[model samples]
Target: MRYIISYVSTVNPNISNSDMTALMDYVRLNNNAIGLMGILIYSEGNFFQILEGEEQTVKMMFEKIRKDYRHHNIIKMLDKEIISSSFSESRSSFTVISDHYNQSELHQFLKKEEEHNPEHYKSISYLAQKFMKFN
Candidate 1:
């Protein structure tokens, strides 16, 4: 069955974009080897992400992402099978440039982000970058 996985996390303030890029590069490489469905990431005071894929693929990918140091306090939002993946394929990712949310919307999104126990937003963000580059 298909599933949607949303996550949130905290990153060290000193993290640089180049470093982040390299880290995401690794995630994209690994996700390609595995079966990463769709990915989206957003950040403001903290980081957030959403991933959609098969059960096994999503679970396996989340497991691997937890070991990475780029993020801490990762949490998931939605983790159930939906009618379809939000992505065109099982290996696509996208960046959410507009993460600005109203207070209520932010609260709702965070509630969802906290419930599903996703990996890290950085991983998802990196995946989006790679996906966009390749796609």
Candidate 2:
């Protein structure tokens, strides 16, 4: 069965864009190796991420993420087994969203960014707004 894990966390204020880019680059690579798929967003010192894959792999990844020092105060929002990955149909198996924008700007940004996938735009924007406590 497939599994999913989603969470929100506070980013370390000291993290620079280059640092995050490197980190996400590694994450994206590792995710592909492990057959993981999902989205990760960092904005205004906050993060919202979703990871889905084999149950064992997803659980193990979350453990590693918990020990990561780049972010803290992780609040897990969703975890469960699913029939399949929700991201399976997405061309970009792993999506990343990050910027210095506020709530309004972020919403506009998501809109413009996902113009190719309205289905993703809906769910992703809703979750992002909710995680930022702006919705």
Candidate 3:
């Protein structure tokens, strides 16, 4: 079965731009090899990510991500089986919202998401829509 997991974490303030770029590159390569698709968004000092793939594979990845030292306060917002991946065309996509304009836009989009459907897959779709808009 397909599964999707969405979580938010506080990013380490000390990590530099180059470090973040390298980290995303590593994630893309590894996720592509493992048949995962997702989008990772970093805004200010927070990270919001949604990962979709085979059930067991996604679970194992989440375990490793939970232990990674680059972030803290990892709170899962959604975890459930899904009909399909919202990002099937890409291995992984990332967006770093550095400007105030895009950050505000993303914040509004997330707030709207909360008022929409509560289904896991739908939430993932909404997140992908917003991610594509900003990135």
Candidate 4:
């Protein structure tokens, strides 16, 4: 089984970029032990990312995030049991470009997707397009 979780945490005002980089290095090195698929950290309007493997791996990674001096208040915005991961291909971990944040649209689409796939975890990307723009 797989899970998808999107979370946010407050960055510690005192932490520096170099410290963050070192912390991320530890996370990258110990990923497999924790069941991480991918991690994306948002700071100063920029999102940093790491992708690992497994549910336990991801959970362990999140635990480290909670204790990191760089982050303060942590909150998980999304979590779900996934039938399959969108990231099975590619390296065990990688970080790169991130897309723009379109919050209202994303939330609205997720709501509708949950409604449509109440029993199964189905993709609602197209349905979101059909309904969200009209409303």
* Maximum-lDDT candidate: 2
Q: Is candidate 2 or candidate 3 better by lDDT?
A: 2
Clashing pairs in 2: none
Query: Which prediction has the highest TM-score against the true structure?
Result: 2
Which regions of candidate 2 deviate over 4 angstroms? 89-92, 100-123, 129-135
Ranking by TM-score: 2, 3, 1, 4
Q: Candidates ranked by lDDT, best first? A: 2, 3, 1, 4
Please give, for residues 30-99, the per-residue lDDT of candidate 4 as tens digits. Answer: 6534546554544353333433355665566667666866666666655566675544433344332112
lDDT tens string, model 2, 9-47? 998888888898888778768787778877787777888
Give model 3's TM-score versus the native structure.
0.67
Where does candidate 4 stray beyond 4 Å?
Answer: 32-35, 45-52, 96-135
Please write out the lDDT profile of model 1 over residues 12-124, one tens digit for every residue.
Answer: 66777677656555654665556665433435435555656678878766776678676778776567777754554622543232233223433333344344434443444
Model 1 TM-score (2 dp): 0.55
Question: Lowest summed-lDDT stretch of 10 residues in model 4?
Answer: 94-103
Note the Cα lDDT for every prediction shown: 0.54, 0.76, 0.69, 0.50
Candidate 3 residue runs with Cα over 4 Å from true position? 89-135
lDDT of 3 by residue, 1-135 (tens): 999888988878888888887876687678777877665676666777877888999999999999988989999988999875555343243333333334564454445444543444465556545544554
The per-prediction tally of clashing pairs is 6, 0, 0, 13
Q: Model 4 Cα displacement at 4 (Å)?
A: 2.2
| Poorest lDDT segment (10 consecutive residues) of candidate 3 | 91-100
- What is residue 79's positional error in candidate 4, in angstroms? 1.7
In model 1, where do residues sit more than 4 Å from their true spots?
A: 42-45, 90-135
